[model samples]
Target: MEPILSVEHLSVSFTRYRRGLSRAELSAIRDLSLTVEPGQVAAVAGESGSGKSLLAHAILHILPRNAKAGGSILYDGAPLTPDRAAALRGREISLIPQGITYLDPLLTVGAQLRRGRTDPDTRSRCRKVLERYGLGAETEGLYPFQLSGGMARRVLIAAAVLDSPRLIVADEPTPGLDVKSARRVLGHFRELAEQGAGVLFITHDLKLALSVADKLVVLREGRTVDELPAADFRRGQGLTHPYTRALWQAMPEHRLW
Candidate 1:
């Protein structure tokens, strides 16, 4: 089957400035490329500041204006650019960032969902999505401030899937939630993939990735150092690359805490 999303030799860099000094270029991602086939779940894992989020933003064309990007990002055989990428986001591709602040403060959850959707049937679809994620109608009618942390996270997720995008890119989707809620959310993503939506699950939690991802891609210093099947991940086998081994060693399961 053809890849739902294909990234080739993609690179992204940002410019930073210091007082009384010229701007400096900081490379966030370098020569990173991967593919997400229909109904596949690929996990990208690394320490913070390892360009995991940058890779996602580059694919979605949501990188900051000061950032420069190069290389080809194709969605369904078409090259993705700022103009064309906008049409893909939320309709063909959706992203759920790490934080829950994507929603508006003043708008009710229902209103926010309606605003982010691409079609008119969003209201009913939103209700179904919320219910599927264990959220109730009262949660949808309330404002963001009125909901719990996990409820707000579910709302943001509902907004992302309101249009049933063919690919969903989620960054650390399980942070701050209890173990049970995390498991529920991961189960939902599994159902989404089973139904043929390609998912890119970016996370730092190796245990969660092992349980949820079909494939794992390990990144280090803006490069993909390892890629392997999820079965290998479950076995706790030593990684082929040194960086990947270090990542596994740093996982919570291996920690003394």
Candidate 2:
């Protein structure tokens, strides 16, 4: 099957002004390549400052003004240019951002999820998706401030899946949730992948990635050090890179030094 999303040798950097008028390029993502196949949850697992969130922003064409990105991103077999990304973002592609601030503080959940659609069908789907995520219909009337961390996280997931996007880019989506809530969010990602959406699950948690991802791309210092099946990572079977092995041994469930 063709991959729903393919990122090839993606590099991201920022222009910084040192002393005087001199400028320098600070590379954030040196070299990265990964693919999200339809019906697959491909996890990009790394430590903080490993360029995980930068990868997500690069894919979405939402990098900051001073940032520069190179390499190719293909979505559904075509180049994902800025205009193309903007066009398909909320329709064929979606993002579950790392922060609740992505939600509009002023808009009710229902209004944000609707995305300007006044049709009954859209409204019905929105309510159903909220319910699917264990949220009541009344939750839609609440503002972002009114939600707990877990509820806000679930609301983010509901919003992402509202359009039945073909590709979902989730960046550090489970940071503040409890273990059970995190597991539920992971289960939701698995379910979405099972329903034929490609999921790019970006996080610093290798254990959480192993729980839900089919393929694991281990990143360190903005580079992809190892890419393998999650089963291999689980049993410490085929991790060749020193960093990969270190990450494996560092897992709380596998503390054998």
Candidate 3:
């Protein structure tokens, strides 16, 4: 099956000015590659500052102005250029950002989801998306300050998926949620993947990734260290990289002490 999202040999670097005239180039991501096919969830797992979020930003063409990206990113078999990314962003590409802080403090829930558009169809779609996430119609009338942590998280997801994009890039989306709510969110991602969407689930939690990801791409220090089926962790097999093995052995359920 053709992959919905393919990132090959991707590298990102930033140029920084030092002192009066000197400059330095810092590499944040190096030769990272991963793929997410239709009806699949591929997890990119790594600790903070391992360039996990940079991968998402690069794919969405939202990298910082000083950042430079190398290699190729393909979406649905075509090269994903800046113009293409800009065109598809928020329509055919969706991002479930890490925090509820991404929500607008000034806008009502409805306005935030509608993106300030008052069109009837758009409003209706926004409401339906919220409803699908178990949010009530009255949710639209409330401000962000009025929402609980879980509700704000749900709102972020509802807003991101309002258009039903072919690929979903979620960056540490379960942070701050209780286990039940986190599981519920992960279940929703699985459902989306089952409905023919490709999902790139990024996080630092190997346990969470194993719960729902079909494939796990272990990233360490901005590089692809291991790419294996989630079942490998389940079966205690097929993990060759020392880092990968260490991660497996260090799981709470596997710890001897």
Candidate 3, poorest ten consecutive residues by summed lDDT: 175-184
Q: Point to the candidate with the largest lDDT.
A: 3
Question: What is the overall TM-score of model 1 with all chains considered together?
Answer: 0.90
Per-model TM-score on C-alpha atoms: 0.90, 0.96, 0.93
lDDT of 1 at 123: 67
By TM-score rank, best first, the candidates go: 2, 3, 1
- Cα lDDT listed for each candidate: 0.83, 0.90, 0.91
Sort the candidates on lDDT, descending order: 3, 2, 1
Model 1: worst 10 consecutive residues (lDDT sum): 115-124
Name model 3 segments beyond 4 Å from true: 116-124
Give one digit per residue, the lDDT tens place, for model 1 in 1-257: 89888888888888899789988988888878888889988998877888888888988888889989988889888888789888878778899888888778999988888875646477678788888778887776799889889888878888887777889999888887778878887887888899999999998777788888899988777877788887776666856777767766777777667
Q: Write the per-residue lDDT of candidate 2 for residues 119-231, one digit (tens) a residue.
A: 99999999898987788989999999999888998899889988889999999988888787778778888888889999999988787888899999999888888889989
Model 1, runs deviating above 4 Å:
116-121, 249-257
RMSD of 2: 1.3
